[model samples]
Target: MATPNYGYEKRQKELAKKKKKEDKAREKAARKLNPSSPGLAQGDPETDVASLEHDAPTVPELPTKDG
Candidate 1:
């Protein structure tokens, strides 16, 4: 059986991490340029939660039907 090449695996992991960082930086720059874009807004958790709370449908805590 061939021996595992730890160095190759480590390099792959590092490359993947660097790529992820670069992609995130690019996305952040895009967001800054287009802060009002809907596509980017959905990616943000803060706005998601805030919008959810602000726009949540009414819930009846108690029954209001006629007796």
Candidate 2:
């Protein structure tokens, strides 16, 4: 059998990591350029929930036996 090519494997891993980092940087830059983008707002769960709650119709509370 042939010997394993360690150098090639290492280079492949390094390239993958670099690509991931660059992609993340590019996404961050895009987000910065479009501050009002809907994608950005959806990132915050709390704010999204709050907005939904505000827009949702209110329901009347039922009376309890204690009252």
Candidate 3:
């Protein structure tokens, strides 16, 4: 008959928790350094979308856009 090693399991869980916290801290620091990074962008910026203008079309004015 073998006994369960609860202590080892508990230690492993603690280590995982510590690792997660450290990773979050590192990510926060990276974001602070470059907040505009698209891959890690979170929430919207302070700029107002209403202030933006569409003076130009991205794709050439389609010849048959009216249709």
Q: Of the candidates shown, which would achieve the greatest TM-score relative to the real structure?
A: 2
Q: Distance from true position, residue 42, model 1, in Å?
A: 14
Q: Candidates' lDDT values, in order?
A: 0.79, 0.79, 0.69
lDDT of 1 by residue, 1-67 (tens): 9999999999999999999999999998887677677764664766554566677687778866874
TM-score of each: 0.55, 0.56, 0.55
Per-structure clash totals for the candidates: 0, 0, 0
Off by over 4 Å in 2: 39-67
**Tens-place lDDT digits, model 2, residues 1-67:** 9999999999999999999999999998886676567765764755454566667677999999999
Looking at model 3, the pairs that clash are: none
How well does model 2 score by local distance difference test?
Answer: 0.79
lDDT for 38 (candidate 3): 70
Residues 1-67, model 3: lDDT tens digits:
8999999999999999999999999998886677567754344333322223423436766678678
